[model samples]
Target chain A: MFSITGLLTISGILFVAGAAALITRRNAVAALMGVELMLNAANLNFVAGWRYFWPERLDAHVAVLLVITVAAAEAAVGLAIILNLYRKFGTVDLEQIRLMRG
Target chain B: MTHAQLTALLPVILLAGTAVALLLVQAITRSHRVTAGVTLAGLAAALVAVTRALPQGATPVTALLTIDRFALLYTGLLALIGIGLTLLSFLYLAGRTRLTGAYYILFTLALAGGAVLASSAHFAAFFLGLEMISVSLFALAAYRRDDPAGIEAGMKYLVLAGVATAVLLFGAALLYARYGTMAFAALGTAIAPGAGDPLTLAGIALVVAGIGFKLTLAPFHLWAPDVYEGAPAPVTGFIATISKAAVFALLLRLFTQVHLREHPALFAIFATLAIASIFAGNLLGLRQMNLKRVLAYSSVANMGYLLIAFLAGGPAGAIAATFYLTAYLPALLGIFTLLTALSGRERDADAIADYAGLAWRRPVLAAAFTVLLLSLAGIPLTGGFIGKFYVALTGVSAALAGSPAFWALVGALVVGSVIGLYYYLRIVLAFFQRTPAGEEPAAITRRVPDAAAIVLTLSTLAVLWLGVLPGNTLTLISLLVEEWFR
Candidate 1:
C-alpha cells in the first residue's frame, strides 16, 4: 500500500492551488474548474483518512461519495449561471458584469 | 431505519415528499398558485409534526441526525419562514414568469435542507445539509436569469461557497484523521482542554472560516452586498433570516457539543472576528445608497452582535442568541415583504429615492416599514432593542465571570448599534420626504396580494409584541436551552 502522508501532502497542494486559482481567475468557467479541483482534493483527503485511520468505519468513504455528488450538482448550477451571464453580458469575465454595485 | 427513526424523520420526509409532489404537479398542471399552496400546506404539516414531537425532547434519530427541543423550535421557525417566503415568491413571480412552479420546488428543497442542518449531529449530515441549501440557493439567486446582476451574483456565490465547503470538508477530514470519528458527541471526549495539537487546531480554524463565510462575517463579507443587491428581494430576505439563523443554530450546537469554549485560543479567535465584523459592517453601511446593500451590511453587524452571545457559551448565551433571532426574524420578513409589494415587473424598487414620499401615497406600508426599520436600528419599543439588551447583558455577565474580552465586545456592540441607527433612520427619513417637483406622486399601482399583506401585518405585530413584552419568549428560550444542554 502507498503511504498516506504522501497522499495527504499532494492533496494539500491541490487544495492550495485550487483556492489560489479560484481567487485569481477572472473567467467564470475557469474559476468553477478551480472549485472542482478543491472539492476533489477534499474528497481525496476523506478517502485517505478513512483508509489509514478508521478502516472499519465507512462514514468518511461515504462522505467522499456525497462530496462527488454535490460537486457535480454545484458545477451544473455554476455553469448554467455562467451561460446566463454570458448571454446577458456577452462575456463570462466577472469584472465586466457590474450592474448592481455600491 | 427503524420505527423510532422514521418517526423522528417525519418532518424532513414530509418536506421532501412535498418537493417531489410539487414537481409532479408541475409536470401535469404547471399552476404556480397550486404549487405554492401545496408547498405551504406541506410546511405547515411538518411544523405541526415538529410541535407534536417537541415533548419527545432530544431524541437521536440516527448517528447523523438528532431531534431535540432546540432543533424542533428551529424547525418550527424555519417552516414559518418558508410559508412567508412562499407567499412573497407567489407575489413576486405572478404574471411575470411562467416557471414559478420550479421556484416553489426549490424553495421546499432549501427549507428541508435547512431543517436537516438544524438537526445535524455528524459532519456527513452537516455537509450534505449545507450543500443542499447552497445548491438550491444558487438557483434561487439567479431565478431572474434575464437579469445580468442576478446571474453574476449567482456565479459568485456558487464559486465562493464551493470553496468554503471544500475548506470545511478538509477540516472534517483532519478531525477524523486525528480522532477517528466525525460525530460531535464523540468529539468532546476526543478533544481535551490544553491539548494544543497543531493539526486539531488547524482543523477547527478551517471549520470556523468555512462557517464564517456562510454567515458573511467581515473580511469574508465582501461578496454579501453584491449578492444581496443582485438577488430577488424575497430570496435576499430568505438568506438574511432563515439561512443565517439555521446556520447559527448549527454552530452553537457544534461549539457546545465539542466544548470549543474550553480552548482559550478559539475564544480569542471568535472575539477578534466579532469585533472586526461589527466595525466593518457598520462602517461599510454608512455610505451605501442601495437599500439591499445597506441591509446586507447591517446583517453583518447583527451577526457580530449574535457572536457576542455565542461567545458567552452557556445557557444564558444560548437563550440570548435564540431570543435575538426570534426578534430579528419578523422585522426582516416585514421589510422584505414590503419591498416585494413595491417591486415593478422589470426591477425592484430598491433605490432610496423610490421610497421617498412613500408615506404620502402608501401610508400603511410606510408605517409598517417604519416599525421594521426602527426595530432593525434597535430603537426602544422594538424587538431589536430587547434583542440588543439581552446580548449586552450576556456580555456583561461573561465579563463578570472573568472574560475581559466580553467587556470589550460589549463596548463595540454599543458603538456599532449607534452607528447602525444612522443608516436605518435614513431609510425611515426617506419615507417622509416630499415627492420631487415635476415627478408623478410616488404611488405604486401594484396590487399587494392578501397573503403578502397578512404576512406584513403579522410580522409587524410580532415585532411590536416581542419588543414590548419579551419576557415570555425569553423564559421559554431559557427553558429550552437548559433542556438542550442537559
Candidate 2:
C-alpha cells in the first residue's frame, strides 16, 4: 500500500545514507553526489507530503521546483570550484587539500 | 502586486538591475575602473531607494516578501556596507587579478540576496536568498584561482553550505507536511506554544542547526577558521558581516514571529548553543598566531554574544541585537581594510608578527588599528562596549522577568569577554613592540591608499560616536522595533 509513513521512512534512510557518504568520502565529487542525494530526499518528502496531506495546495510543488533549481545552480558552482582545485593541487581528495591548517 | 507593493520593492529591484548592468558593462568594455564606478553608483542608488521607501511603512509585496520599517532599516545598512566593500575590493583587486568585472557582478548579486533575506516572509524566499549568497560566495572565495588556499576555502564552503541548505530544506518540508502552510505568520499560528509533534520539533531542530552552521556557532563552526584564513581578507570581511547580519536578521524575525521563547525546550537549545559558542570560540582563539584565524574565532564569539540579546526576547532584545550588529560593522570592516592595505602582492599580511613595531613606523595607522581592536574587545569608549552593555542589560532584564537561564547566558558572556580580551590585547601589544634589528619593515613602507585611509578614519569616528552618544541610535532602533512588533 502506498503510505506517507513508508515514503517518509525511505527519505529518512536516504538522508542518513547521503550524510554518511558525505562524511566518509574523501573525493570532492563523491561528496557533492552525497549532497545531491540529500537534496533529492528532501524533494521526495515534499512530494509525499503534498500527495498525502495537502492535495489542495500547490506549495509543495513550488518548493520542490525551487529546491531543484537551487540544487542545479549549487552543483554547477561546486563542480567548477572542484575543477579549479584539481588544476592547482592535482587531486580532488579533501584530505590532501590541507594547506591552511593550524 | 499593488502599486504600493511595487514601490516598496524598489531597492531590491535596483540591486538586481545593477547586477545585470554590471554584466553588460563587462561585455562591452573590460575596464576595471568603469566597472567599479558603475557598482558604486548602483549601490548608492539602492541606498537612496531604501531611504525613500522607509516612509512606506509595512507593505507585503507578495506572499514571499514583506517590506517593513525593520526590513528597510537593514536593507539600507546592507547597501551602505556594500559600498564600503566595493571600494575596498576595487583597491584589493587592482593589479591582483585581471577578471575584476565578474567579482563586482557577484558582489552586487550577493547584496541583492541579502536584501531579499532581510525582507523575505516565506520559506521559498528564504531558501532562494540564502542560495544566492552562498553560491556567489563560493565563486568569490575562489576568485584567486591560482592560490591553493583560496580553492580549498571555496570547496569547503560549497560542500558544507550545500549540506546545510539540504538539512534546512528537509526541515521545512517536514513542517509543511505537518502544518500545510509555509508562511511565517501562518506557521506561527499553527505552532502552539510548547506543543509540537516529534516531526515538528525535529524540523525546528534541523533548521536551527542549519542556521547555526551559517552563523558559525559552536560544533557547526569547524569550517570557519579554515575559510577565514584562506579566503582573501576583504571577502572574509563580507562573510563575517553582510552574510552573517542578513541571516541573523532573518533568524530574529522568524523566531519573534513564532514566539520561540514560549517553548522551553527550544529556548534551552538556543541557550546551550550560545554558551558553547562563547566558550569554544574564546578558548580556541588563544593559541592562534595568524591574525585572520584570530579574527575568525572572535567572530564566532561575537555571534554568541549577539544570541544572548536575541534570547532575551522582546522588543528590547531585537533592538539590542540590531544595534550591536550596526556597531560591529565598522570595526570589523576597518580591520579588514587595513589588512588589504598592508598585504603584499603574493599573500595577505595576516600574521600577528607582521604588526610588530607598527606604532613607531605609522603612528596614525597604528592608532586607528588600536581603536578598532578596542571596539572588538568591547572596551569602554568604543561602539563595541555599548553593544555589549545593551546585550547584558537585556539579559539581566530577561532574568528578572523569570527566566533564570539568561543569568547563565550572561555569565557566559562575561567569561567570554574576559577571555576575548587577552587575544585582542596581544595584537595591540604587538603594534607597539620595537622591531628586532634583523626584521624587515616592509609593511610600514606600503603606501596606504586614500580610499582605505578614509574608511578606517570614518570607522574609528563612528565607533567613538556610538560609544559616547548611544542614546540617539538606541532610540532610533527602539522606534523601529516598536513599529515592527505592531
Candidate 3:
C-alpha cells in the first residue's frame, strides 16, 4: 500500500486543478467536465479511505455508485440546459448569459 | 409492530403509494382535476397517518428514519403546504397551460419526495430521498416546457444538483472507507476515537461541501436567483419552502446522530459558510428587483439562520431548527402564491413597484401578504418571530458555553435579521403606498384566485397562531425532539 502522504498529495493536486478548471473554463460544458473531474478526484480519496480506514465494511463503494449515478443525471440535465442556452442566446459562455441577473 | 415504527412508515407508504397511483391514474384517465384531487387526498391521508402515530412516536424505520412527533409534524406541515400549491397549480395550469395532469404528477411527486427526505434516517435513504425530491423539482421548475427560461432553470438545477450529489457521494465514500459502514449509527465506531483519521475528516468535509450546495449557502448558491426568477411562481414556492426545509431536516438528522460537537473542524467550516451566506444573501438581495430573486436571496439568509441552530448543537439546536422550518414553509409558499395571483398573464413579477397600494386595492390578499412578511421579518405575533427567538436564544446560550464559532453565528443571525427586514418591509410598504392619487391604478390582470387556496392560505392564520400560541407549538416540538433524541 502507498503511504498516506502519497495518497493525500495526489488528492490535493487533483482537487486544486479540478477546481481551477471548473472556475476558469468559459464553456459551461467544459466547466461541467471540470466538476466531473473534481468528483472523480474525490472518489479516489474515498476509495483510498476505504483501504486505510474501514477495510471491512467497504461502504465507500456504495457512495461511489451513487456519485456515478448522480453524475449521469447531472450530465443529462446540464446538457439539456446548454442546448436551451444555445437556442435562446446562441452561446454557452457563462459570462454572456447574464440577462436574468438579479 | 411498534407504534413508532408503524407511525414512521405511514407517510412514506402513503406518499409512495399515492405518487404511483397518480401516475397510473394519469395513464388511464388523463384528467387533470382527478390527478390533483387524488394527490391532495393522498397528502391528507399521510397527514392523518402522522397524527395517528404522534402519541406513540419515536420509532426507527429500518434505522433510516426516526418516526416521532417531529417527523410527523414536519410531514403534516409538508402536507398542508402541498395543499396550497396543488390548489393553485390546478387552477393555473387548467386556465393557461396545457399539461394539466402532468403538473399535478410532478407536484405530488415533489411533495412526497420532500416528506420522505425530511424523515430519512441513513445516508443511503437520506441521499435517495433528497434526489427524489430534487429531480421532481427540476421537472416542476420547468413545467412550462414551452418557456425557455423554465427549461433553462430546470437544466441548471439538474447540473448543479449533479455536482452536489457527487460531492456528497465522495464524502460518504470516505466515511465508508474509514468505517466500513454507511449507516449513521455505524459512524461512531469508525470515528469516535480510533477512526478519527484524516481520511474520515476529509470525507466529512466533502459531505459538508456537498450538502452546502443543496442548502444554497453562499459561494455555492449561484443558480438560486436564476432558477427562482425563471421558474413558475408555484414551482418557486415549492423550491423555496418544501425543498429548502427538507434539506434542513436532513442536516439536523445527520448532525444530531453524528454528534456534531465532536467535529470542531466541520463546525468551523459551517460557521464560515453561514457567516458568508448571511451577508452575501442580504447584501445581494438589496439590489434585486425581481420578487422571486429577492425571495431566493432571502432563502440563502434564512438557511444561514438554520445553520445557526446547528451551531448551537444538542436538543435546543434541533428544536429551534424544526420550529423555523415550520414557520418558513407557510410564509414562503403564501408569498409565492400571492405573487402568482398578481402576475396576471405573464410569469414575471420582479419589480418592487408592481405592488403599489395593494392594501387599498386588495385588502384580503394584502392581509395575507402582511402576515407572511411580518412572519418572515420575525415581527411579534408571528411564527417567524418565535422561531427566531428560539434560534437566537439557543445560539447565544451555546456561544456562552465557549463555542466562539457559535458566537459568530449568533452575530451573523442578528445582523442578517436586521438587513433582511429592509427588503421584506419594502414589499410590505408598497402595499400601503398609494399610487399618486390618480396614477393609472397600476393596471394588472391578476390570475383568478382559487377558493381551495383560501383553505390553505393558513399563512396569515399560522403567523397569528404560532405567534400567540408559541408555547403550545414549542412544547410539542420540545416533546417531539426530546422523544427523538431519546
Candidate 4:
C-alpha cells in the first residue's frame, strides 16, 4: 500500500522545489513552468487527501481535474504573453523588461 | 439544474451568452460602436435579471452559487461599472485600433466572472470564478499588444497571481483533507472554537496570504503600482474597482461565515496587514509623480481602511465596510474616466504636469477631479469622510472593553488620512495653477467625448449625493447586512 506519509513528503518537496525555481529563474517561461510544477504538487496533495480521507465525496477529484484544466489555460495565456514580450523586446528575460520602473 | 436554479442563474447566463454572441458578431461587423452597444445592452440585461431575482430573496443556485442580497448588490454595482467602462472604452479607444472588439468581449467575460465570484459559497465555485477573472485580466491588461509595458504588466500579474492561486488551492486541499467538506458553512460546523488544530491554522494562514496578494495588502503589494501604471486607463479602473471589490466582498462573507474573529492569532495577522498597508501606502505614495501610481498606492491604503471595519467583526463593521466600498467606487471611477478623456493620441495623461492649468483649460473636468481627489483624501463634505468616520466609529465602539488592537487601528487610520491629504492636495494645486509661459495646451481639452462626459457627470452626482446625504444608502446597506448575515 502507498503510504500517505510518502505522498505528502513528495508533494512537500515538489512544492518547495517549484517555489525555489519560480523565485530564482529569470526567464518568464521557466517561471511559468515552476508555477505548473507547484500546481501539480497541489494536485497530488488533493488526490492524496481524497484517497485517504474523503473517498466518498467527489469534490477533491473534481477539484483536481479543474485545476489541471485551469493550469493549461493559464499556461496558454502565460506563453502568449511571453511571446508578445519577446516580439516587443527581442528577449524573454524578466530582468530586461524595465520600461515601468519608478 | 432545476428550473428554479436556472432562474436564479439568469444574470450569469445573460452575461455569458451575450459575450459569446458579441464575439461571433464581431466576425461579421467590424464596428467598435456596434460591439460597445451590444456590451452595454448585455450589462443592462444582467442588471434587470438581478432586479427580478432580488425580490425572490436568497436562493441557492446549485451547490456552488447562492443568489442572495449581498451577491445581488455587488453584482448590480459591478454591472453598472461595466456599462460605464464600455462607454468609456468606446469613446476613448475607438479608431485607435481595428481590433477593439476583443476588449468588449473580455470585459464582458470579466464582468460575468466577477458576478459569479461575488455569489460563490463553495471552494469549487470560488476557484473557478477567480481563475476566469484572472485569465481574462491577463489578456485585458496586455490588450494593447503593441505596447511593451502592457505585455510586461500582463506577464507579472500572470506569474504572481498564479503563485498565489496555487498557495490558495494547497490551503484548500489541506482544509478539505482535515474537515471533509469544502463548503464554508460545513467548515464552520466542523471546526470547534479554540480547537487549535495545527493543520487548520496553517491552512488558514496560507489562504490569508493568497487573499492578501489579491487585496494588494502590504509586503505583497509590490506588483500593484507597476501594473496599474502600465495597464490601459479603463482596464486599470476595472481592476481597481470591480475586481478588488468582488474579492473583498467574498472575503467578508467567507471570514464572517467562519467566525474568524474568535481567533486572536488571526486577528493579529489582520492587524499587522492593516497597519503596514496604511503606513506603507501613504509613505510610499508621497514621492510618486505619476498620477496613476499615486492612485495605485492610495488604493492600497483604502484597502487597509476597509480592513479596519472588517476587523471590528460585528454587524457594525460589516455595514461600515459595505458603505465605504459603495462610497469609494464612484470616486475612483470618476478619476479614471477623466484620465481617459484627457489622454492624448501619444500617451495617457498621468503625469502631474498633465494637469497643470487644467482648471483654466477644462473647468468642468478640473472641478470633477477636485471633488474626486477630495473624496479620496477623506475631506469633509465628501463621501470618503462619512466612510472614514463610520470606520473609526466602529473601531472606537469596539474599544469599549474590546482589545487595544481596535484603538491602534483607528489611530493608524487617522494618521494615514493626514499623510494622504498632502499628496492629494498637491494634485489639486496643479489643476488650478496658471499655465506656464510657452507651454502648449494639449488638444485633449477640446475633444471630450459625449459618453465620457456623461459618465463623469453621473459619477460626480453620485459622489456629491452620497457625501451630502448618505442616509438612504446607509439604511439599505444596514438592512442588507442584517438579512445577509442570516
Q: Write the per-residue lDDT of candidate 1 for residues A20-61, one digit (tens) a residue.
A: 888788888888988888888888888888888888988887
- TM-score of chain B in each prediction: 0.98, 0.99, 0.94, 0.97
DockQ winner between candidates 2 and 3: 2
Please report how far candidate 4 places residue B145 from its true position, in Å.
1.5
State the displacement of the C-alpha of residue A57, model 4, in Å, after optimal TM-score superposition: 1.7
Judge candidate 1 at residue B44 and give its lDDT. Answer: 93
B407-450: candidate 2 lDDT, tens digit per residue: 99999999999999999999999988888765845776588999
Candidate 2 residues lying further than 4 Å off, grouped into runs, are none
What local lDDT does model 4 show for residue B387? 91
lDDT of 3 at B423: 89
Residues B1-486 of candidate 3 have per-residue lDDT tens digits of 665576668887888888888878977887777887898898889888878877774677776676666677777888888888787676657656766776776677677777777777677777777777777777777677567778767757765676677678667765765566777766754467323577678788888888899889998999889988888878888888888777787788777777767776777788888899999999899878777888889889989888888778788889898888878777887777677666655555556778778788777777888888889888888999999999999998987888766777888888899999998888888878867656623423353365535733666687778888988888888887886566
| Model 4 bad stretches (over 4 Å) | B441-446
User: What is the lDDT of every predicted structure here?
Assistant: 0.86, 0.91, 0.76, 0.86
Q: What DockQ score does model 4 reach against the true complex?
A: 0.80
The candidate scoring highest on lDDT is: 2
Instruction: Provide the lDDT at B298 for model 2.
Output: 95
Sorted into a CAPRI-style docking class, model 4 comes out as high
- What ranking emerges by DockQ with the best candidate at the front? 2, 4, 1, 3
**By lDDT, highest first, what's the ranking?**
2, 1, 4, 3
Candidate 3 residue A96 C-alpha distance from true site, Å: 3.6
Model 2, residue pairs in steric clash: none
